[model samples]
Target: PVHDDDDDDDDALITDAITGKRYRALRHEEAESLSDHLLSLWMRAGPGRGAELPVDSYKESVLEAVRASQVVVMVVITGCGKTTRIPRFLLEGQVRRVRRAECNILVTQPRRISAVSVAHRVAQEMGPALRHCVGYQVRLESRPPERSGGALLFLTVGVLLRKLQSNPGLQGISHVIVDEVHERDVNTDLLLALLLSSIKNNPDLRVLLMSATGDTQRLSQYFGGCPVVHVPGFMHPVQARFLEEVLTEMGRPTPPRRDREEEKEVAPDLDLVADVIDHIHSNREPGKDAFRADRRGRAGRCQPGHSYHLFPRKQLDRMAVFPVPEILRTPLESVIIQAKIHCPHSKAVDFLAQVLDSPDSQVVRVAVKSLMDIGVLDAAENLTPLGERVACMSCDPRLGKALVLSALFSCVLPVLSVAACLTRDPFYNSMQNRALVSKAKAALSGSSCSDHLVFSRVVQSWKELQGRESKQEFLDQYTLSGASLRFIHGLMQQFGENLCEAGLLDASAECLRLSSGLNQHSQQEQLVKAVLIAGLYPHLIQVKRGTVTKGGRYRPENLSYRTESGPVLLHRSSANRGNPDLSSRWLTFFSAVKSNGQVFIRDSSVVHPLALLLLTDCDLSERGNARPNHSVLLPGHSLIRWEFSPHVWELLWDLRTSLQAMIHRSLRRCDRRSTSGGCKDSELVALLVELLNNTDPEPGSDQEEFSTENIRSDRL
Candidate 1:
């Protein structure tokens, strides 16, 4: 039931009208007699009976092209049936012989939902025995209960890259169909480059670059003019309208505009969308006056008496047809890790330069620097033991770091929930079910403005209600995605297993369960927040106050924050968006991006100034080499004058160092017996627990912000 807007296929599940029984399409059976009834059903239900797709005509050409060349460029639009049908064509085309080579066709998709959906469609067509033959492998989940051996395997682009780490030559895969190459995402580009290199050694390995809007000539040239196959798609006609025309037809007067500075402080008027929809329904006609508008300028009529045709002579582009390559748009921590493991000898920047359409040099540099800050990569750009483990996780490098630290602190359950939520599709719809989802989330969140904690509660409630009610009913009541919930659960279990392997938790404790001795830390709010800091440090924003105006009427005073770009308000969907009293002076945000001409923080959590210092990378001045007024200087010369003196700062530093050592020792113990008893209930944990529990702020300190000035300067 999880639908991706990117997929345009109109195929629905087949059902019998008389019996109301749903059935899969008849599949080819190797050892069966084709009776008259079975033959009639096959003829009626198979692909040939429906309006023949363009790919059906090109099956011979496609197979011949694969036999002739090592690479092929397939430029087919959406709904051409290329994604689901072409793979089966290749698989079934194999000649039955005494010695059949392992000919597994690997089709890689850009999104997980696409891979799972396409695999299900292919499985249904392949019939029951072939149910195991057509399967998908995505992060945290795999169908058919096996790692490999699916005749036609569908997986995400990132998963394929991870596979390359183990089998750089892609040993068993015969043909790799890189779908949506037009996206030019970081994973797809990296994967294509690696495959091209592998094809030189293994010429038998076939590559197919498929896209709806790709530059065929460019791709063909990249493969040394590989054969290009064109498959025409069924296109749908759409109606278009400009905003100004819609407003005129609806008889809504335009509001006066303001200066650029005033515009930055105003929120978008979303009510206009509903008004346009209502007008379209109330006034739409068949032939005449359907979309006609008055031809008028602000001062005078544009054409005196004639009605202006609203449709443009040329089609107007609504949004960018292609995606911005992820290197430019997203954090590159995970990509950096992959680069190190796959291209070991080359530095991250050097290896990335060899990729097709490499990201900007500064962007790569910033990514490497961020990884170093998080202790994933050392000063020499080597993977630490922590980095080795983090690379195995299927999430952002920072979130992986958070999970590791949470395990060390014996608070893995909630942190696992937070980590899983970050790497999956959102639990609720902010557009249609915003108010209801928000009210439920707020009730669970209590006084915490941390979106991570709020989501943890939401997921925990869903878990508690799992058996009492059906999953679909629970999802309907909460307006959540069932697939996303399953994805989160899969990741939580995956994290627990990985933590056990890394010796961060007791071997006996499975799936988010902590040792009994360490269970008390799971209940502490400050400890969980501190673990989040270890992962999401340096992405901090200083909260500021501003005012927002809408239509010159609803001008409300607003509290906003500052990113490198400019001032940004929180998304209305955020738990902390309009609430200023929930520890809102400063916060750490997940991402800051511009949408609808205004920048906004997607998700954020508040951190106390002291907690920030304890969690971040800091060093105390040596006794002999002290700064004036006992100041503790962070990176970039952001100095913090100690509330007490040098000695108090030194004591706090020593205590933190001891706690880190204690955690490391606990993680290094290999035997379950050694990990089960002493370390979990040690006096060190008790002391650290007491320290985190203290909430009283230092009375006379004048520090107003905890800034990552050093981090920013290093990136520059």
Candidate 2:
């Protein structure tokens, strides 16, 4: 944010909270954050930055390697410009040099914005030779006169999957760049598996996987030895160090399971975040390092009575550093600073305020200056704007998972509560939050019903107020930290701006809704969670709902005995603990045991016994049974076995097939395609209602009341 005084409007440059670097503010009309500046360099980089290849060095080597083989998957590092340079290599003639080049170069990104951004950058570099040469295609957005000629297309991984699903041949695509493969996104993984199946026949397609160094190795092997290529980075070689045992350390940037998909197990990046943290910590002299002391008083609440930004009421003139606002910030992403305000407060707080206010932390202070050197406790003991964002995002520790989910379903709100579930988590050794995690989990189960994407749009809508002044005023009504309130506000603004820059103006509208308060927050995440299940189908852990808890807390009670059915909460992050706000629900047993024979007091929707039998559990093809028995046969990998009677088996199979087809269709239709102003979402509603209502195996015994015995049968 700009630091200015009415006394000297021209002195707008902000003082650094560390390393006394002074930057004179420029009165530019546009607003750009540090990330924007850095990323701008990437987007606008020219062949000027590229070193003249040693005639046959890196770029040529990559081309030669991929061209010789029918299928090539190569690993490259960040900053090496794989995303930027790979296309150049092909366009250089040797690859795409002459002859009627009919093949279209295709690239896929995790987020739609990344796809457009990369494509725009590449097209800019191609210049006049390719006015409309490079094009990008997203779910609802496309830019290309026609899909003819040799063109490079950038699209989201999910979008790519959808395209391939409809037309396996992919109608024109020669080279593919799956940038950031180390991320292991569900779409990317699935694309890999699916693409692998096509590799044997698609003689024209060549795949190149670009990943970060120090981490891409494993992903390389997973693909069975795609010739791995490494590019040395331009980052000033900072020291690299490792810490085998530090009581605790930062976890992965986003929860890998946010895609709502599951694998046999999680792949830890001890060599990434931890290693980087360790490298930083170990390099500094014990007594000379800096420390950060930032905390959030509480999160924002919706109230018509107060301003959400907490401004004009109890002015910052009375507070210090606003107790560091809670926002989710990663090292990457664009952030714009408007005005930086300093608060006045307690002695320690004041000291931190002063230190953070300093141009840099290289100097020392007597009372509080000494503490400024290390980040743990800022001289003023307050969080800098940057620190506050980091803290809020890190509040859940499992922010990675939450962020990952944001990318997929775009539901950061429920995950916001997931932060609560993360606080005071039961150690991985202990299952304290398991119950709630189970509940948070139910939000995403069942493929039979729909409303899957609604929750996503809901959270994205709720995120709108993050930076808006109205919201901060609302927070002031409570004793909430202004910084925390503003942090999220800023975070939302950042995401919104990114969506715009990514050219995700259309598809991102659903995600950008996180910044507009378009969708009212729904208590039910099932609508969104179900999509996660669809994406991560078959990788579930079912819980029975009728069992009672003994209350030791660490142990999980009886889980759904679904012959098949899980958001693999990040392996060991605080998500393992229940974020009270995020993970509040639990799975109950199936016995239908009444809390007092009341039977219908507090209840959760349970799946149909027959539905589970048809879709998840059944093997023996029995012939006479009319009802789906409580003991359903289960198939491994969640595929149901059909051991029931012909009547039961046929009925179950038909019901399941119908539900599956409808769900898959619903998944393909974007919320934007519907015109019913929310009413349009009824397709999923219709499917869910039908699935829920048709749970009875015996038409005569159609009971709406749910029995725990049929735990997996009830629909969302």
RMSD of each: 11.2, 23.5
lDDT of each: 0.64, 0.39
Per-residue accuracy of model 1 over 294-400 as CA lDDT, tens digit each: 23211121111213323222323433555567767777778889888887667888878877667788898888998998778887788876787677676788888
Task: Name the TM-score of candidate 2.
Answer: 0.37
Query: lDDT of model 2 at residue 633?
Result: 40
The backbone clash count of each candidate, in order, is 1, 96
Worst lDDT 10-window in candidate 2 = 331-340
Count of backbone collisions in candidate 2: 96
Top-scoring candidate (lDDT): 1
Residue 352 alpha-carbon offset, candidate 1, angstroms? 1.5
Worst 10 residues of 1 by lDDT: 297-306
Tell me the lDDT of model 2 at 82: 70
**Any residue pairs clashing in model 1, and if so which?**
635-710
